[model samples]
Target chain A: MQDDANNPEKKVISDEEIKKIAQLSMLNLNQDELEMLKTDFGNTLKLFETLEKKDVDSVEVSYESSKISQPRRNDEVLHDNKTQKQQNADTSPYFNKKTGYFDVPPVIETE
Target chain B: MLHKLSLKQLHDGLKNKDFTSKELTGHYLDRIAKHDVNLNSFISVTSEHALAQAQEADKIIQRGEQTGMLTGIPIAQKDIFCTKGIKTTCCSKILAEFTPPYDATVIKKYQENNSIMIGKTNMDEFAMGGSNENSYFGLCANPWDLTRVPGGSSGGSASAVAARLCPGATGTDTGGSIRQPASFCGISGIKPTYGRISRYGMIAFASSLDQAGPMAPSAEDLAIMLQAMAGKDSQDMTSANIEVPNYLSYINESLKGKKVGLPKEFFQDGLDDKIRSKIEDAIEVLKQQGVEFVEISLPNSVLAVPTYYIIGPCEASSNLARYDGVRYGYRTNNPKNLESLYKDSRAEGFGDEVKRRILIGTYALSSGYYDAYYQKAQKIRKVIKEDFDKAFEKVDLILGPTTPSFAYKIGAMTKDPVKMYLGDIFTIPANLAGLPGMSIPVGFSNNMPIGMQLIGKAFAEPEMLNMAHIYQQNTDWHTQIPEKYTT
Candidate 1:
């Protein structure tokens, strides 16, 4: 197990680490929850104790259902390509005149 | 009339013109209306569309254009599958008003085979709970005894098939979802190897473990439905591209040379005496057919529940993040900001069980804890899989009681989620290993059905089905339904 210094004196989790985990989890924890997690983060680290014991070299990991691994799909575009703006602009749920974005109901409430 | 017929019998009747597809479909619809009000097995009954499809099937049959093996058979689909224009709520309030614009790959295959979709069945919200009580619509009562639970999260599918509401149903299993319910409800259900069926458009609970398979009255019926449901689809990149085996063709094969392994750990303490006796009886029957039983050890199975709790919920927490009340579904009434929107919408949309699992999962997969929980669970999961792999080298399949005990009365385990989760103890290892497993009726425990699970090596469902079929042929347990409930 790689033991890195966990900046114990720090009051809150570093923004970089928080951002990285948030992106992986797709969660938007508020400031309060994030603060709470700083103290609780050590508890989460307990899983490492279990993983560290495993002998990965002898694990013989097999993800394939069959012995033969088939080739992946060809990397050819079946249709005409669209501009980047054309792909990004449409945010409308019904229909978007801008950049082809599908705009659904707003996720947040306005004050 | 439809209620008494199995899928194979129904198909034969349709093919021989003994009964038209339209009449059979109507009969099933009428049965659903009469039974589902009390059983609470279905969330929505697509009677109009089902009848129309039956008419189309009749036309196809008349023209001698058979679409596939299961032409004109009525089957209920668990609500996790997104059926175009129908409410595809995973039995959660979050997706109460949500309707998908497309169909799950399994549903599409059923349509291609000319199967009549009876209705969408109820389930635990987001497939989170062991009991069907977690459903937003209400608990689906067991067909055998109204007060007891039909095990979940495919409880509705199992109950419907047991009560004969639909000849069969499609259910997704992440961790013991299909087999457990089949065990409780006294029917046959199979969870095929992970990636055997396409996950596209099926609201996923866990990416690595989630698999869709069939629940029905008999292993033969399950085999027939699995033929249509299994195989690769381009939409789901993870789908297995292996050749689809002819499942039905192997259903009646003899198991004389087969070796069935019984894991010693599974038969230890906590198993009910009645269930144990029933399993022993099943073994004797198998032995009479020249099938041998070998005792093996799965040292890691003791840790299966903990490993599953971490992995299933961790993946679930991630999978369910898609329901942010944004793209499509029920949104919070009023939210001051994005944070409140996400929190409140989820709080309101999800049931208590769903929230509890989400919290546990989030905690496990979080940064500081990832190694302790998720990584640890993954490593242990590997151990469980290795245990199975080593055992399979000496046996054609493994057999054990599907659950340590029979189904409990409603509200029995509702207060204790952990205890309720343990109901899946005997079954979850298969999902962890991505192997095909099934539950077939052996006998009764306290007059309720006792199911013996037959787990095969990955993609060995055909062999498992043959073994289960041999046992059923020698015993009358599969033929015995809850006598009083039929009235």
Candidate 2:
């Protein structure tokens, strides 16, 4: 396990890479924000690079509760359309709703 | 005077007719109205709802119905926990106008126990930052010194409790959100073992690490609150199916014959000299009480901060993907297309810290870098957990300082994200290992309170609470309130 903290080879995140990441994250960042993020991502990734130095070849990935297994529930509909409609009404103020459905841009274009 | 009373005292007072629940609730509401201006602890003060609940509690008490200690007690949620019809924002603009249709499991538990819902406290946006400065509302100042940040992301909860604005409040700890703020505010908070409390309605920051617990003036109050909040829930599959212990029963347990380990790694350089000495002095007090202390090692401790930051952000990236402008939450108006809508809404909604973490997370989990970053970090997380397990085999509990230093001035570490991440070095291991941990005020450094952390094995909260309660019995640090906030 080699410590990357002092390793001369640091992973430099480029502006193009940050742009790709923002696109994947569905976040719209302007030029100034992207510039700032490039520097921050580089610094943070350098810190994370040290993880490669640790001897974790045999360690298992930790996920979910250590002792508790995911409980299985009966496959049944708990809430009806009426209940869902009420919830939609509660959230209507935040989204554009028309005819009891959230109005969104067309997903497909006709040829 | 009512605000100063412990949960048990308040419950007894209610039962004895010394003060009605409405009166107690009003007293706290009045205090929040008057004092919360100086400390932006609350995001929404539910005055009307609180009064109505208090009135209902009075009727129950008047009828001599069997009730728990928390009944009729006024308390605040951390704003992360959803309450029916109350705006449950994670102190983030994305959910600023969003209201929950139902209560979180913990909130439901509190309601069932007949507790008054005082309000929702401010927090780090999406529980991301180390200081409350990341909140969309405003920075929640330390009650001790307004310029200093109340350590976050549970800063609002810690500040409200410290200022006596509420007798107790609910706080969620992912990384050191609960304990660090508890330490900074000179109060007590417990981050129960993962799955000890259900997280069905609590907004997810990091699903595997987030656990909601109580912040209050004393360990006894935390025990009472924990007793109510801890249990299995059908709604949360991750919640453990174990029986909830009566934490109150174990508060008086003697510390005699208990082996408390002092982790050597936690005492290394970077800890403030004054806080180190203060912890040492407190250890002396515990020593005099027949509790044995031994030097122990968590060899992989140094990697905790890096491991947590990677895993936390990665999970956050995935969890927060649901906040697209369509179903609920803040939606961008007049979008040309769905893609633009998502980009614009998130760009306009999330704060800088949230965006930073999301980017870091998105990058880590991206196609080429997933193996290098997220997977490797998860492996290191296992190593960190093993370190705790190995140490716990020889000791009943591990004790250390909660934070590396006293609370830093607001905006001091904001420029350096890594520096802010390091603030949680000592506290991250407990969350990493899914172990129960607590912070208790031990002494002061430069007029600011320092906290001594106690880390116990999984589900060993009763023993940990007993130790903290016994320690409090010998010290008055937890009893001391900031002079400025003391009415």
Candidate 3:
């Protein structure tokens, strides 16, 4: 048996690493949640580690394997302004909207 | 009584005036009210909307107009499909109250046929987990045993059908979501070739893997539903523009010279003894009908679960990036800053399983691990697909167990995510290969239903359904309903 495979603690992800991952994923987890995620991540990653042994050196990655591809249509307006306005209005409740535009936190800080 | 009828039977009944569409819809609504308390199969029961649609269907039938097979039959939509003016939560808190402003192409097709919409059924949150336990609403129990899961993330649709809540329902499969639940619930379902059904408004989980299909009591009923559901749409670029076959007409095709291949790896260790024996017996029944079985090898199929876990989560991480607090869905209240706003809203909206997959996916696609994890998994995915490609050269289709075992008790595999994933071993290869696969109730093992999977080449649903239909005609397993659910 491999030395690291037998040691359960060997793959334990650090708290800082988990925090960085959560940040990269745009998730804010509490300290308790972070600890739980670390253990869960460790277990799942161990399962994923089995892929390293597979021989895929000659295989090519496929994005879309389907042979049927539709020809692109000429660019034309499919929807009227009313439909666009309704769709815009639908998202008004989730964020700050002023004059049919979404309002967000300022990108730059000024004194 | 109306709930007991199949889609074909229901269509005939409506035409013969044996029952009105409104009465049929009312029967299912009453059952949903009476039994859904225990099953928790439905997220929202649209009685008023269903009655209104049924009344409209009755008018069409009265006018002596030619109508499709699903004209007035009641059906449920899996909550993942976007329904205009109806709440489609996907059983998650993030989109808990969000209503789509337009109908998904599948919903539009059913509505155009005037099929009564019973309700939106429950599912694993965002169709993530194999078991229904991951839903924000609550776990859905198997209608057969009540203590067991109905299998997910399409568990609610399967349970609702098994319990006679509706004639049929729509289900989406990424990795065995439809077929596993169909197997566990003793019903029938099919996951057509990837892009066979439009995914324009079906909420994305894994884009390349997800395909929507029908769930019903028998392959014939599924054919009836699939006739109405399959086709290309301009809204979804990935929807296949291939010829949609007349599945209903092909149901009675002879299986005399058809070839069915059994993957040697599928019958190996980890499969339950009883389920294996039942599948063997089912193969004998098909053999008597003159169907020939050839031994085939899918050597890389053993890697399906690992490959699926990597690719599924990675795509999910990128797809779910749209759920930030910017536009629609749940937003964190009073966020201090932009980063916290994105973080807190997602952290608060998503459940544990969803977060876990997001983390795994993000880590897989992270700077240092991309080539080792996500890219490598994709290459292995091609190998898995090739295994099926080579097998199809010698045989028309492949046969296997839908799941390795019968439905386990609710919460049994929740603690260990890997064990839950292992349950999908037999079903994941079809998704990886983007082939059409069906599951039909072959027999019972320990009083629980065992489903035998029939996988066909891309867009070969008619052939797959024909094989299953012939098997159903020779056996009575698909007609057997749970005693507790049957009145």
Q: What is the interface RMSD of each candidate, in Å?
A: 7.3, 2.5, 2.4
DockQ top scorer: 3
Question: Positional deviation of B454 in candidate 2, in angstroms?
Answer: 0.7
A1-111: candidate 2 lDDT, tens digit per residue: 123332324548777898999999999999999887777777777777667788777777767438656667789876586876777565556444446666667777545
Question: Which runs in model 2 stand beyond 4 Å of their true positions?
Answer: A1-11, A70-90, A94-98, A107-111
Q: Summarize candidate 1's per-residue lDDT along B1-487 as a digit string, tens digits.
A: 4567777788888888898989988988888877788899999999999999999999999897755668888889999998987889899998887777668898999999999998999998888877899999999999899999998999999998888878899888888899999999999899998878999989989888889999987888888999999888888878888899998789788777888889999999889999999899888988889888889998788777767878887888888887775555667776666666666677677776776566667767776877667776777788788899899889889999899988899999775565676678898989888899999998886679989998988889899888877677777666555664464
TM-score of each: 0.88, 0.96, 0.97
TM-score of chain A of each: 0.40, 0.68, 0.70
**Model 3: residues >4 Å from true position, as ranges?**
A1-12, A95-98, A103-111
Native contacts retained, all candidates in order: 0.04, 0.68, 0.60
Report backbone clashes per prediction: 24, 0, 0
TM-score of chain A of 3: 0.70
Note the Cα lDDT for every prediction shown: 0.80, 0.90, 0.89
lDDT of 1 by residue, A7-71 (tens): 22333346566545544444545666555554334322332233455554555444333343545
lDDT of 2 at A42: 74
Cα lDDT of model 2 by residue, B452-473, tens digit: 9999999999999999999999
